[model samples]
Target: MKTLSEDLMLLIEREISGQASPEELVTLNNWLSADKKNIKEYQVLQQLYRGHQTLLRNNIVNTDEAWQKVSNKIEILQNSNKKTIIYRWYYVLSAAAAIFIIVFFAWVFRINNQVVTIEAVAGNEQFLLPDSSSVSLKKGSAITYNRSFKKGRSVIVKGIAYFDVKHIVSNSFTVITNNTLIQDIGTSFLVNNTITKDEITVFSGEIKCINLSTKAVINNIIAGKKIINYSKGFVVTDFTDTNILSWKSGVLDFPDVSLTRVLEDISLHYGITVKCLPIDLSNNIYVKLHFENQPIQEVLNEIKLVTKLQLRKGNNEFIFFQSVKNESSQIKKQK
Candidate 1:
């Protein structure tokens, strides 16, 4: 299901602010013109926004309540029409309202609560913090904090981040993720984020994992071990199963992951777009791919060579589809 379109975010600002720059206006016009369905889609979203506007203007809907209602509506829709049209429109409406509420409350809390805004797009990004610590961000990953970290202590994260945390004092720093909060004596780690979320290996040092939203957490895990959620709670894992920070070694580590997600990661790393046409793969396509020390095109060629996937250019870079050929290994099989 297509959850909200990215273009809607920009349009919300233009419409609400009523000060669209000449350039923005031109861009909007062009985008709407480029797609015959754009106007119809835009109108639908506008109608959705009006629902929120009515609640806001009438002061009948508490901001939080409105969002909660939206979330509740979302949960209901997800269960009933998971892969259907209702799921798509609900998400679009939900996210658009969220943006509006965030900006509105931001003004109200501007003086008291300084929210640190961070976004991770579909591309790999490098981060160097104030204390000389570093983080390598994966595509479609992100982390944000309400304020900056002080004394190399705990930091909150919303998306995947490989931390080369700066050395702190006798106390271990902490990292708060979606379902759990990790307390570290000193360590490097990886956190996988999604709408549902997951976590993995702590490369070095020890960590005390605790549930942030509930009463659950691992007692601790020393260096070279990993932790993954079993839904009930977190469990320890071994690096032998999968090496963490393999990306640092110039490879992506995917064990029975979705093929579309795999293509998405490749696109992010190569700064290109890749797709699988009419794509439906076993979703459990477990494969470890290494693209170390190679040019992006070479990487693409390698993937093509192995999967017999075809490369298509020009809606974006690296955008490719699996070729229609009966290859020996069109899709890698599990052992």
Candidate 2:
């Protein structure tokens, strides 16, 4: 009897689960064709996997009932005194136990390798990781980790998120985004990943940022520092955006900021599009405002009052224009 190696067992399990890659399938085929015993081993494992699936679907919760059923089948097989029949049954029963062990460990391996994804679809979302670290994702942001997250503290992030990482000296927290890896050195940080660039800001403690593509160490960003990584290179600078976490905080602060910049922030926070018709109005006007958890309509109304710009709403979009009265007055002045 040829014994199956752990690698061969895994390959058979992947084939049984229909998860084997093309190369893996070719390898399994070659092994199966090599010998008759290998084919028998594969058959036994396939039967085990199918039996497990059936047990799951049937909700076989009582272990004693299952064992009794197996014992009854064994007694029936024992009654067959023919030498060949008895030998085949004995081989099957013995292989069944070994196959069950392989299946059990394979199931555990799948569970440990499972991927967990968290997304903020309609609104901002907050979640606590396995290690009790907290993450706040902006609208349209998402993060993914493995089921064994505590053992290996790594997450892939998309869009923007704020992470208040729980520090473990032995295992460092790592955030991967847009071909860049940001490893926490006991830090609370914000990462903004866009199509064009990635922005990382360390709020407390420090972080080591690296470019995954080039395998280059970007910088060790300390608290109150930021790294903006572009396609060409990266720049480390002083962090200045206080409202960077406004989506998570539910506060939008614009202190003497241009109307254009404020509208851009508003669009991002509300997950909408804002357009100024003339475009000049956005550039010329400056806003000094603070809002906390206000409705989009209320915020736009307030902006209309201050900037005196006409507002129009469309599907997932808002347009601002100079009021007809203001346009007429300006025309008269020009004439």
Candidate 3:
């Protein structure tokens, strides 16, 4: 079977972080209700994470220390050997199906209750619905679907979400934002609605992108490619990082695009500003740059070394500008 959706991962993260929505909270409760073992497992996981919080808070542990504690817990559970060991089946056999039901029930009850403001905060944030579709928002990202979401498969997100959607018989799964609706025929994707244009890149399968900013939708997008959105709607734009699969793989792929554009993408990915100042002389030149799974600093250095661009820090942003030599070269060529 396909692995758990990014939405599920986000849900798990939200729950652990305690950033669950009312619907999500109910979903968690419902899951706890479904199987006695689920509650037990949740309790175990909770206690384990509590140790993580304590150690980190006390400064007795660093990032590695926090993660190692969790890892140790996992290793302890796994080494117990579910099939052969008496307690093995509980952790070894796993309860993926049963856990899924927990998400389903929580969503159902929350929807029926007409929840208006189910916001996710920072930890273990997840929501389960009756349809077996789950959404886990990223930190600081918020999502809102109609309380009638179960009746009509639609959601509005303002940050990022990983969706684990159960297949519908014939309809496509849609995540609605302000200007367009991202439609997937049941695939996993990470959506950053925080973009000025609100973009969605499909990690797997196909997504039908439609812009609804006008009275009627005036644009369309396909999977494996990204649609750059303008203020009012979507315009066909190049996906510099078409190969980046935030799902399945954590790789961020940047393909052949403009340097200026690439900087914008990097800024979005890292939540920082990388802009060029006094950009000129070589405005229209397109470079084939690839930043495959590299650190931002490394990527930045690569860009600087390759393009010989000048950079300065201004207003919390790395301002980019062309060197004076490039301008002189243009002047000499004109003569």
lDDT of 3 by residue, 11-53 (tens): 6456555455434443444444345576445544444444444
lDDT string for model 1 (217-293, tens) is 56668777877764456667676634245445566656655666667776655556776665564243445466565
Q: Of the candidates shown, which would achieve the greatest lDDT relative to the real structure? A: 2
- The TM-scores, one per candidate, come to 0.47, 0.65, 0.45
Model 1 worst lDDT run, 10 consecutive residues = 106-115
- Off-target runs (Cα >4 Å) in candidate 1 are 1-114, 146-148, 241-249, 252-290, 293-297, 303-335
Candidate 2 per-residue C-alpha lDDT over 37-98 given as tens digits, one digit per residue, 9 for 90 to 100: 86556655655555566556665444466456556666777667688667867766875676
245 Cα displacement, candidate 3 (Å): 6.0
Residue 126 in model 3: lDDT: 74
Candidate 3 to native Cα RMSD, angstroms: 19.1
- 2 or 3, which is superior by lDDT? 2
Q: Is candidate 1 or candidate 3 better by TM-score?
A: 1
Q: lDDT of candidate 2 vs native?
A: 0.75
Q: Model 2 RMSD to the real structure?
A: 10.8
Clashing pairs in 2: none
